[model samples]
Target: DQQVKQNSPSLSVQEGRISILNCDYTNSMFDYFLWYKKYPAEGPTFLISISSIKDKNEDGRFTVFLNKSAKHLSLHIVPSQPGDSAVYFCAARPGSQGNLIFGKGTKLSVKP
Candidate 1:
């Protein structure tokens, strides 16, 4: 069974808006969460991450929030642009393994 899940397959946003992507995981042992963005025919690139110790982490226009109790997380992009349009994935790392478990991904479209 998949431990990480992205229930939304896609999301749309207008230019200069805010975009939100959500993820949920069943494993309580997950100590770190990351979000990655990908373009067509390209590998995903790291965006933002959050540790279980903190509830939120921000970098520039991107922010990741983790809720340990709910076993959920989310990524927020402020002033979403057309360049931000891509496939977004949520991933988690367990306390022991360096390997990451990834979600299905959500494709975000930013229209001008």
Candidate 2:
């Protein structure tokens, strides 16, 4: 069974707008949440991440928020640009030493 799930298959946002991507997980043991962005054939690039100890984390234009009670997490991109268009994968780690479990990914299309 898939532990992580990205309900939306795709998302489209206009340039300069805020883009929100959501993810949910079934495992309560997960201690870390990570977001990765992939551009076509290239590998997925690490975006932002949040530890279970914290509710939010921010890095430049990217932000990640975790709601442990709900077993949900979301990634926010402010002033999204066309260059930000990519497939976003949501991943979670069960513990410090555990491998990450990834969602199917949601393709984001930022239109100019």
Candidate 3:
């Protein structure tokens, strides 16, 4: 079973537009949600995160929203730039250990 799923394999956006990525999970044990931004040939870097206790978290141009009842989450990047073009991965960890379960990934291409 796919514990985590990223429906879109890729997305394209204009430099100043908003880019939205979606993710869903089936495991109820998950209590923490994280978003990672990855560039070519590099490990994913933590972007933003939300806990099951809260519904939303935001940083600079990035925001993450979680819906516990629906077992769903999303990431939004505003005024996306070329520098933001990369693969975004959604990860979740259960209440105990901090090890993460990851989605396939969504590649975002921001045109200048």
Q: What is the C-alpha lDDT of each candidate?
A: 0.94, 0.97, 0.94
Stretches of candidate 2 above 4 Å error? none
RMSD of each: 0.8, 0.5, 0.9
TM, every model: 0.97, 0.98, 0.96
lDDT of 1 by residue, 5-111 (tens): 99999999999989999999999999899999999999999998888999999999998888899999999999999999999999999885679999999999999
Q: What is candidate 2's lDDT per residue for 50-71, written digit by digit as tens? A: 9999999999999999999999
Query: Between which residue pairs do clashes occur in model 1?
Result: none
Where's the lowest-lDDT run of ten residues in candidate 2? 44-53
Mark the regions of model 3 whose C-alpha exceeds 4 Å error after superposition. Answer: none
Residue 82 lDDT, candidate 1, scale 0-100: 96
Q: Model 1: runs farther than 4 Å from truth?
A: none
* RMSD score of candidate 2 (Å): 0.5
Candidate 2 at 64: error in angstroms? Answer: 0.3
Alpha-carbon lDDT of model 3: 0.94
